[model samples]
Target: MATGLLALLDDIAGIAKVAAASLDDAAGQAARAGGKAVGVVIDDTAVTPRYVTGFSPSREVPIVWKIALGSLRNKLHFLLPGALLLSLFAPWAITPLLMLGGAYLCFEGAEKVAEAIRPHHTEVQASAAPARDPQALEDEKVRSAVKTDFILSAEIMALTLATVAESPFATQVFVLAVVGIGITLFVYGIVALIVKADDAGLALAREPRPASTLLGLRAAPAGAPTGGDRALGPVTQAFGRALVRGMPVLLRGLGILGTAAMIWVGGGIIVHGLESYGLGAIGHTIEHAAEAAGAWLPVLSGAASWLVTAALSGVLGLALGAALIPLAHYVVTPVLRSLKA
Candidate 1:
């Protein structure tokens, strides 16, 4: 009986070791995969803050939390499983699907540019509607945000899966789950912080006391020395005021940058896909240009090459996206609306 019990304990220890190792491997792979999807991640982060815009301060954090939950649901419950199934039975289809997603991103980015250049009357009318229940409006915004997140999350998951395609099936699943959960937490945490920053700044600016007082400053006996004893309060208040003033500009800049990133990433993906499928003319021409630039300025070679490639890709993405805009607005939207009806 003693020997049998010892054998059982030994087996348990072995299984624990294996489980630990698998988790470590999964974590390593998750980080690597997440790195590969950083471009999409930036776009995700950039795109999210806009959803909370014009919302009441009290509603912002809750809205972000709901959207974050939706994003996680999209990734874990939908995209991850779908990605796994695709990798398992139809690996060959992954590239084409990814290219399609890239095209969609390009379309979205270009549409935003066009919208900015020529604001839509329909959107203006929609915004002008008589006041509705705030909660209902909030829910609509959450749904819109989630729908956008689903597309971005799908791209992130597909990129991650492609990065880990050679791993065992179980490892692939584990790695994807880790990346999904980690990214959702990271992205939403940042969003929450960003959305609340103005409120935080307002509080800080309005409160005359130094931040140290909030952390249990010792009471000064007979007014020997207090928060007003130093310049910290005024300085902090000034900083807070600056933050309050700067946040809107910062958010706008982020929105613009995100849209540009979407176009750049989408363009790069399409170009790379073309190169992979034997239509390498564009890529080769870009490479040759980059090399020539490098030879002329050896010190800036790498940076110049990257800049050339990125510039061409952005142009390509913009053109492709512009071409698709009419088709999407006229054909695709009508078809989708008809289907829904």
Candidate 2:
């Protein structure tokens, strides 16, 4: 009995050690994968805040929550299995799929560039037109945001998986799981903080203590409510004021930057992918030119490389996106409209 019991204890100890090692490996792999996806993650963050636009203060958090839930579903239900299957059965397809996603990234980025250089004329719904219910509009935005999140999330997951392609299968699964959950939580949590900052400021401002209230008013002004006015304190009030005034501008900047990133990342991906497939002459030529240009200051070769790459990518993205506009306008939209009709 003593011998059997000792053997059992030994086996349990071994299992525990294995589990600990696995945990460490998972954490390391996850960190590495997440680092590789910094670009997609940034683009995701930049795109999400716009979804909360035009909603009442009370509704913003909930809408974000809904979209977050959808994002979770996208990762767990669809992306997780798809990634595993692709890794197993069709590893060869992975690069092409990534390139396809990269192309999409380029197209989107290019489209945004066009929109910026030439703002569209949105004909406002006629006053006589039936007004869209505020709730309905909010719901639509949430849905659209989730759909967008799905694409971005897929790209993120695929990129992460690609980064870890050489790892053990279990490690890949563990890394992806941690990255998906961690990113989702981090993103929504930050968004929640952003959306609620004004309200929190107001609550602090409206506190009953006179000095506290005065300080709050001064500190947070527009954000916090004020004394006797139901507005928060002066500090909070100012903060709230600043937040209200600044949020639109901030969102617009993010939009522009995100669009630029899409184009930048997209074009870069395509160029790199083409290089991978042995079609790198254009990229090589660009690099050579950049190198020669930087010869005047050999120390700045690295910065020159980055500038040349970015400029080449942006110019290509702009041109491709511009050319596609007429095609999209004449072909894609009509096909879609016809399909819907």
Which candidate wins on TM-score?
1
Per-candidate TM equals: 0.84, 0.76
Q: Quote model 2's TM-score.
A: 0.76
Report the alpha-carbon TM-score of model 1 versus the true structure. Answer: 0.84
Q: Pick the candidate with the highest lDDT.
A: 1
How far residue 72's Cα lies from its native spot in candidate 1, in Å, is 0.8
RMSD (Cα, Å) of candidate 1? 4.0
Q: Give the 10-residue window scoring lowest on summed lDDT in candidate 1.
A: 218-227
Reference-based lDDT, each prediction: 0.86, 0.76
149 in model 2: Cα distance from truth in Å?
Answer: 1.5
Write down the worst ten-residue block by lDDT for model 2. Answer: 228-237
How would you encode candidate 1's per-residue C-alpha lDDT over 1-341 as one tens digit per residue? Answer: 99999999999999999999988887888998898677678778877888988888988999999999999999999999899999999998888887897898789889989999999775367676798898898999999999999988998898788778888999999989989999999999988888898998898898666666655674433554464645667876887898899888887877787788778778887887888799999888878987887888899988988788777888889999999999998999999999999
